[model samples]
Target: MLKRRLLTAALLIILIVLEILYLNSTTLAVIFAIVVALSAWEWAGLSGYLARAQRIGYVAIVLFLLILVYSAHSFWPTAITVFLLSAAVLWWLIAAYWVLRYQQQCDLLPNSSPLRAWLGGVVLIPSWLAVYQLHQQYGEYWVLFLFVLIWGADTGAYAAGRLWGRHKLASHVSPGKTWEGFAGALLVGALFAGGAAYFWLDESEALYQIGFVLLSLATVVVSVLGDLLESLFKRKAGVKDSGQILPGHGGMLDRIDSLTSAAPFFLAGLLLMGSLS
Candidate 1:
């Protein structure tokens, strides 16, 4: 299982790198939209929309919103984009609270609830927009940097959890995670961010370098929240894996859950630092 998982991860990394290196921003947007649509389909199932039609309807709604946002965003001002990204960051903060306070209580938001549907939108659309905006405005390198931080953090967490993990980070939400793993993730992510800032960012200022590392670490922390939020949903839904789409990875949703939360927060950080202007 570990071998398969590693192989799958390697292949995904290669493909994603190629996409970032070769594809135009518009093409990347389309690809990201497709991914979001797939994730929404899986989320629909987790939300108790089991029928084929129900899932398709959910995907349709998500796609429509994506289109609407993409179209309307072109005419909107920069502040609007920042506002939307900020809203996504706020949503994830609330999601962090939900993950922390989650208990096996009665399903407050039942399956097929409109609230769940809206939650899916909130969880997905801003991520797509943030990623697309980053790739289009900043360049593919920034997107690649974001991916490196997330992937590095995940790899660090997994390795550390397996080797030295003792205390559970959130046993109720995800049994495999540990505080040791979380620390490992922060360490790895910060190292990568510092190295990248020194070598690739072309910035000589110490303050900027420090800020970049801190931002990367913050993104890594929130990526954990993203994973926990999904685990919370899966626990409530009583499913082991989100779906069996990848050989070792559970599904598209499972693969991208961290990205879903990280993208917006990363973008917000970039904006706050006046990196994008």
Candidate 2:
């Protein structure tokens, strides 16, 4: 399992590096659409709609959204901000529902059936918009920063969880996640973000380090939220893994959840930095 994962990840990393660094933005956008679309498909399964008809509906909605997002002006930043806000609110509402239902003896997601058909619109559209935003508004370094932070956070959380995890971060949602694991994730993610900022960015100053740490911390929190949000859906859906895409990992949705949360986190950080500086 480890061997297959490493091999697959290594090959995919090579392709990603080549795409972001060497390929044209349009080409990268096409690649991003295909990948994110597949991720949306996986999210459908995680959301507990396994029928082909249901999957098709979700996919159709997602595709329509991608078209609309692509056609919009200032799509990148605008779309990402919109996406981040929606995701944040959705998670909050879900959390609130969980709490409220605890007293009422009702299903928190009594009719989440429609969500499977519509959530792809929420999840995938912004993703494509975020890809566009990164490609058009930021340099390759920032784009790569967005991707690496998510990957780093997930890897850190998993490794640390396995090694030194005890206290559950959210036992109801995801039992495997621990506060220790969360701390490890923050450390690894911040370290990776700091390195990316300092090295890729041609600046050498204390302020840069400060920015890196703050941004990295923000990225970590958002990434964790993304993971937890997905876990909420999975628990509601009553599934172990999202799907069987990766051997050790779960699915495309599982692989990309961190990215979904962190893209806007870093983008917002970028905006704040731009304003302050």
Candidate 3:
């Protein structure tokens, strides 16, 4: 299992690197849109859409929304983007609360309900917007930074959890996660952020290092939230993995779950920093 996971992860990392470095903004946008659409298809399954047509319809809606956003981006006011991003962050907070307070109660939502289908939009859209906007404004380096932080935290958590995990982080939502794993993620996040800021980032100062740490910590938190929320959906839907697309990764949604939360939060922070600076 671990070997398959590692191999899949390595291949994904290589593909992501190539995409970030070589793909132009327009090309990347199209590629990411496809990804969002595919994730929506998987999310539909987790949302209890058993029929193939319904899942494909959900993907079509997601694609339409992506196109709408892309077409109207020029008209989308700065205030609106920030507000939407803020809303995305708040949604994660609510999800975290659901994980903590109403772990079982929240699962009572009907499996066939439309809410989960809409939720795919709520999760996928902002992430795509954030990725495209970051790539447009800050270049692939900044976009890569987002991916790296999430990947680093995820890798760290898995390693630490396997080796030294004891206390549960949120056993109701995800039994495998642990507080020790969370700590390891933070530690790894900090190290990766500090190094990336100092080495790869254009501006590397003490203040930047501090900012990166804070940003990274927040990213790690939200990334975990994303993972738990998906677990919640899967648990509610009575499924184990999201899909069987990737050999060991389950699905694209499973792979990018952390990014779904991290992207918006990270972009919001970056936009705020840009406005201030």
What are the models' TM-scores?
0.94, 0.83, 0.94
Model 3 clashing residue pairs (backbone):
none
lDDT of each: 0.88, 0.70, 0.85
Residue pairs with clashing backbones, model 2: none
Worst 10-residue lDDT window for candidate 3 reads: 102-111
Give the residue spans of candidate 1 off by over 4 A. Answer: 77-79, 103-112, 275-277
Error of 1 at 276 (Å): 10
Q: Candidate 3: where are CA atoms >4 Å away?
A: 77-80, 103-112, 201-205
Global fold similarity of model 3 (TM-score): 0.94
Residue 188 in candidate 3 has what lDDT?
92
lDDT tens digits by residue: candidate 2, 172-271: 6677889889998888887886676667665656786688678878878877777776776777777876777766677777777766766655666666
RMSD of each: 2.0, 3.5, 1.9
Clashing pairs in 1: none
Instruction: Encode model 3's per-residue lDDT on 71-172: one tens digit a residue.
Output: 778687475578669889888877777777645554444445598787778888999989988898889988888898888899899999999999988878
lDDT of 1 by residue, 1-277 (tens): 9899889989999999999888998899899999999999999988888899999999999999988888888888486687789889889878877777663432344454677878989999999999999998889999999998999999999999999999999887898999999999998998899899889876557777788889999999999999988888888888988888888899899999999999999988988888533
